[model samples]
Target: MRSIIRILGVARDLWPTYAAIVVASLAVAGTGLLTPFIVKAATDHVVDLTQGNASGIATVVWLAAALLAADLANTVLTNVSGYLGDTMAARLRATLSSRYYAKLLALPQRYYDHELTGTVINRLSRSITSVTGFVNMFANSFFQMILTVVAVLAITAYYSWPLAVLLAVIYPVFLWLTTITSARWQVLEAEKNQDLDVAGGRFAEVIGQIRVVKSFVQERRELEVFDDRYRRTVRTTRTQSRYWHTMDATRRGALNVIFFGIFAIIFVQTARGVFTIGVMVLLIQLVTMARQPVFMMSMVVDSGQRAIAGSRDWFAVMAELGERDELPAPVPPTGRATSAPVEVAFDHVSFGYGDDDAVLRDVSFTIRPGERVALVGESGGGKSTLVSLLLRLYSPDQGQIRIDGTDVASLPLEELRGGIGVVFQEAALFSGTIRENIAYGAPDATPEAVVEAARSAGAHEFVSRIPAGYDAEIGERGLKLSGGQKQRIAVARAMLKGAPVLVLDEATSALDSRSERLVQAGLDRLMAGRTTLIIAHRLSTISSVDRIITLRDGRVDEIGTPDELAASGGIYAELLALQASATTRDLKRLRQFDIRV
Candidate 1:
């Protein structure tokens, strides 16, 4: 009961629609009662009368005409109210969808890591549909049942108040059944919904990484896992369906038997002359009418339970969302004369994803404006983690990160992110034309500026070679282009944004020697007057940077120019020697390949 009220609270803004639906439902019930009364009158006068008098026949005709009029009115009212309810539900769905999307965008990146994308998508789809459908149907059913029950009681009382009182005897039993079945169904629905989430998550995971599965020859293993999950889902649905079917059958069958007994008793009284023919006919019709209202009670309860299960999921998402603080009024970009170009700084920052296992411990670094700094380290050495912090994808557990002395946390997040550009290791690109992809963040950039940026990023030659040139459509994630081509386009996009600071995460590591030269030339031009942080595994990529910082165990191991670090005999020196050895092996392999040919 408490949960139902809470769900209805969400509908406070749509109560006018609810009220209109109520009115139409009452009209339907009133019409149903009139229909039976018309039959009662027609039967008593024409069929039970002596000599079939013309006056009686005319009276029966009038009753039939009245029934037709009532039916028309009921139809119109129902159509109007049904339309209003549908419209209100649509609006509510829109509001909920907008809130869900906004919450996703506002959350920190860590939230995404902990949750599955498919689970979130499935919840948004199913819960919204369930909640809205339940509200609409439940409202109509409740109002119609109330009016029907009242009319039945009035007619039954006219026959014999004692029997009407006897009919009331079954109310407690029906109510008890409604409560128990509803609770059971609610629990079952919740279980089924969770199973769906799991199944969807698994399916999405496998599909997204199908190449990995195939390459490793794990297709049979993955299929077996999926089949197990699917079988569990089917079993759960079967159990729920069985419970619902048994409950519905028992409730409906018991009510019909009780109403039949009432009708038989009334017929006995009519034969004995204790009840008039007209009254007996009305009693029979009203007893039949009682069946629908009683059955409706069960449906209303069932629908309510299903809705509560769905709304609970919906509200969980709403409650768990993080609040985004409103942005301050826009301020024009400052730091002209006194303001330096993009200077990146991290101040005594200690941070972790969730626990005390810090990824960056007391990390402090400052890159002077217009300097190119390279962050190099083994995988999981906190190099990428540090870049994520700079991007404000996650805030530090302690201390602060600043851009040009302004703490990034204090600035509007949009403005802060807009001031810097990054090219990820994977070179993430959406499906779109080359021109559109290059100006993704800068939608208003002119075509000439876009072409110029592409030229500066060494992408113009290859793009021009394509059939559509700059207008060529790249498939999803730029799968249509080579890995090097995608990276070059990513660089061109960053250059087009013209942000003062640039962060490149293994930007050129995937390219061949020729493509690397072209992309390197583009990077040099883009980094000329901007502060740049480069994360690279290849030794050659970072040699030209102003400084190289080697990371070990979440802290800086060495920071110096390339020559200085090479001679320091620290972690940097060892890494350089290992890479040089690998390169020598690769060259020898090429020679062997030529001799074999």
Candidate 2:
């Protein structure tokens, strides 16, 4: 009940609409009660027809007309309430979805480190569907059931104490039995839902990565895993179903016997001249009315329990900390700030992922304004983590990172991220028009700005060759483009951002030689006059960086100009010697970053 009330609070502005729905449901209940009494009155009037009263015919006719009117009202109000319920449920779904998405966007990157993308998405689907479905049911049927139950109990008790006592006893006992089943049932249901959620999550992931699955020929293995999860659910369902039905059968069986005994009492009393036929008829009708809700009571409890579980999951995510800039909501970037490059400093930073050994221990370095430095290290030596920390993807455990001597923690996330443009090994493009992808955060970017950025990144030629030019729809992640094309578009996007600080994480490492040259040219253009941090392994890519910061076993092993580190025989010289043994390309690409390796 508390969870349901809390859910209602989520859309509290809709309270007036809910109140109107409740009124309509109440009227439906009122009509249901009116018809039963009308039947009783008509039956008694028929009894009077057999006597000396000639007015009984008209009385019966009027009673029948009144019963029809009550039924008509019941139909009309039910339709109106149902329509309201559907619309309210839709509004709630939209409200929940948009808020959930906003929270997801604002969450720290670390939250995604241990969670699957599909699993997070699956949570939203499950939570919204369960909550909205329950809301619809509550407005359409559950409210009416409560009203009907209370009205019938009151009406039944007034005329015949014995039938009322039997009905009252049966109602509570049935309710008690339902409660017991409901408790255990919900516990089992929670477990089943976990299985279902995991299955759903995996299903989406598999579809997204179908190419990987098929290339590895692990289709059979995935199918077996998916099959095994569903098979477990089937076993759980059998146990859950058997228990619920057995209990429900027992409850209904008891109600039926008690109702039969009440029926026997009414017939015996009426035949003995202790009651009238009209009274017996009314008692039967009222009892029948009560039975329907009593039977449906389990379903209501079940739906409520499901909703409670769903709401719990939804609120759990909602309860997590969104990005804490320690300031008011971030103002939007008006336009690119003046590109006066700022010095970036990492001061004695120490950190790791949750419960893991420290990946970076007491590491510190500084990049001067307008200097292009390259970070070089063995794989998993915290090179990527270093850049990530600079991006404020995760906070450092032991030190502050400052840009131009101001602690990054003091800056708004919008400002901190907005000032830095990054291009990674994989060009993570979204499904949208080429122009939209290029101008992602800059909604006000004009077509000319977009084209200029594209031309600067060397994407304009390919984009122009396409039928739709900038209007072309790039499939998910730019799957329609070749590797080089995607990287160029990514460069164009970064160029469009016009950020004063840039980070390049092996931006051309994944491309072929031809593609690498094209992307390298674009990256060179993007890196000019900016404080750039480059993370890469390719000799041609980093040979021109003004300095090299090398890491060994998670500590700063060397930080010097390439020639100085070459003699120092530090990590840089060692990597240079090793990479020098590999394939060679034109020396011209190194001119942009400039190292003497």
Candidate 3:
């Protein structure tokens, strides 16, 4: 109910429009009610004329004119209300959609970690569709329906309170029956919606990773899983429908019995001359008018239940804690000017992905200003998690990460992230042209700047050979490009960001020797005069780094210059030994590192 109330609060912003809709709806009901009185007068006049005691045909003609006027007013007012309803619905959808989208963007990354992409999208679609429909239907007709029911009851009671009482009883009976069925109906709907969400999520995942599905030859199995979810919904809905319609029939039966009793009295009295035929006719017509609203109440109740469900889902997302950056958005950096290199520090930092098993434990380190450092470790040693903490992708559970002595959490995200550029382990590119992906965050980068960045990353050669060059569209996730090509483009993207600090997460791992050599040369030049953190298992990448930080078992095992770490025989030295080829020069280098023969 509070969710519904909040939706009404949304209407408060456009009160004038909504108020006008209500007024026009009432007017429509008024005109509709007048038709019954007009018919009564015409009937009375016709009776008088047959007895040759009425005024001439002028009376009949005037009655007909009055009836037409009421109908014309009904038509005009109904259309006016309908137009306003449409306008209100459109505006409400826009307001609701904008708020939902803003909430999605502001939500923390952890929220997405457990959710499916399609489930997130499907919730928004279903919620807004049902909510807007409910609002529009309720505004356009429910108010008018209530007015018509009231007018009919008032007019009927004037002639005979008995019929009015029976009519009044009909509504509460119908409402009570709907209430009895509502809880079960809602339960079924929620269960079915869950199944639908899972099915929808799988549908999206399969499409996004179609290559994997096809390569694994599991197309039929995937289809069966999708079908199974929808089938479950079908069975649940079947039970729901049987219960609802059975109750609906029971309500209708009660209504029919009540009306039979009311009609028996009206006709028996009219035949006995207890009332004029015209009054009896009016009573019957009013009863008919009231019946329509009573019938519509059942439909309204069903829609109301569904709307409540959707609103509950919608608000659940809105209530999630979002990233805090109350300050206004910073404009994108427009020029090549960079921040002076700043020292980065991790102070006894520890973190985990939800569970108690910490990925990084008491990890403490410092990168001096403008130093090049490499993190090397065996798999599952927290090398990547450290980088994620540094970028504020995830916060450390125990301690603070700082840039130049200021806590990273206290710095605005834009300022913190804007000063550092990263090329991730995977080249996460969207389906767009080469130019668009290269200049992703900086959409306004000139062609000359984009070309210069591409050339630096050794990507300009292949790009120039393409018929469309920078304009060539890469398929989803850059599928049209080879893995090496994709990696080069990612490097080019980071090159264009040109931040004073750089983080490369195995950026050259996809390239062949020749390509790696070319890209590494470019990276060597980019590292000059900039603070850089490199995460690598390959010995070749760390050879030029000023220092190496090694992680083992979620703790910092070693931190030293390349030669010092090599002679210390730590994790970095172990990795270099494994990547080394079994040649005299390689063995000599390993022996030099003090590794046991």
Candidate 4:
């Protein structure tokens, strides 16, 4: 009931439409009361005509006309109710979608790590559809049923109190049946929802790794796994259906048996002269009208339970997410023209996705206004974590990160992020036109400026080769493009933003030799006169930087010029020797392959 009320809270803004629906519903249910009156008039007129009375004929015709008019009004109300339901569903979808996107963007990285992309999609689409059904049918139908019962009881009292009491007794039995059925279904639905989440997660995983699945020749195995999941879903759905069907059969049987017994009692009363023919006919009409409302009310109970469960899940997500407590408002950065771009300093900063073990530990570094520094480290050594910290993607637990001597956390997040451009390791691109993807960082950028940025990043050549040129559509995640092509497009996007600080996290890690050279040249031009921080795995990328910072176990193990660090017998020296050895081994393999061919 609380869940229903919470969902009804959405109607506060649409009360006018809701009020119309309510009034129409009451007016429709009120017509049930007139059913007995119409039957009474017709029955009494027949009795009068047998005594040669023509006066009652006119009254009979009037009552018949009244019944027809009431039926017409009921039909109109039904139409109005349906229209209201549709509008309500549409409104809810819009509200939820807006909130879902906002919440998703604000949620911490830890939240996403445990959630599947497909599950999110399912909740937004299918789960919301179920909620809409629960709201429209369960709420309105149940209210109308209550109104009908009250109206019928009042009319039945004037005809026969004993009959009304008998019918009222059946209400508790129906309520008990519905209560049991709904509780059972609620548990089933919760289980079904969890199963759905697992299924969705599996589908998303398979799609994302289709290439790996094919390469490993495990396509058949993956399909078998998916088939098993589908079978489980089918089994659960069948079980639920069987339970619902049984409940339906039981309710219908009970209503039939009880109504038959009531009719028998009323007939005996009429035959014994305890009630008139008019009164008996009126009793039947009253009882008949009550049947539909009762059945509808039971259905409402069932749907309401499911809806509440679904709503609780959504609210749990909302409560867990809460809201990001960011600054309400903040001043923009004014350090661009202050002799230095902005001195970004990290003081003993440490962070991890979760727990006490930090990914970047006691990591202290500083970049002057226009300094170009390179972060070089082995895998899992925390170079990427540093870039993430600088972008404020995650907050450090131990120390502070300052930009221009102001704590990064103190600045408005939007303003802080707006001053920096980062190209991630994966080089993610959306499904859109080349031009749009490049201009994503700066939405209002002019077409000429977008073209210039693309040219500067060396992406314009390949983009021009596409059928639509700049307007060419990129497939999902830019899967249609080569690795180098995607990286170049990402670079173009960052270049177009033209922020004062730039962080490149292995932006060219996936590209081939020729593409890497081309991208490296573009990056060189982009890095000039800017505070640039580079995270690279390849020794070639770090060789030209002014300073190399080596990370080990989330801390800066060494920091010096590239040659100085290479000469020192430390972590940097070992890394250089390893890279040299790997290069030699690669060349040896290539020569051997040539001789064999």
Model 2: per-residue lDDT, tens digit, 30-118? Answer: 89899888998888888878886645367777888998899999899989998888888888999889878888888899898867787
Model 4: clashing residue pairs? Answer: 361-554
Q: Over the full model, what C-alpha lDDT does candidate 1 score relative to the true structure?
A: 0.77
How well does each candidate superpose onto the true structure, as a TM-score? 0.88, 0.94, 0.91, 0.90
lDDT of 3 by residue, 44-130 (tens): 889989988786899889989999999999999999999998998888888888878888887777888899998887788888888
lDDT for residue 92 in candidate 4, whole number 0-100: 75
Candidate 4 lDDT tens digits, 354-410: 765778878888888778788866567777777777777777888999988999888
Error of 4 at 304 (Å): 0.9
Candidate 2: clashing pairs of residues: 543-595, 544-593, 544-594, 544-595, 545-593
Tell me the deviation in Å of residue 475 in model 2.
1.6
Q: Kindly state the number of residue pairs that clash in model 1.
A: 0
Please list the C-alpha lDDT of all candidates, in the order they appear. 0.77, 0.82, 0.85, 0.76
Q: How many backbone clashes does candidate 4 have?
A: 1
Q: What lDDT is obtained when candidate 2 is compared to the true structure?
A: 0.82
Model 4, residue 198: displacement in angstroms? 1.4
Give the candidates in order of lDDT, highest first. Answer: 3, 2, 1, 4
Candidate 4's C-alpha runs over 4 A off are 32-36, 46-52, 55-64, 238-256, 322-340, 583-597
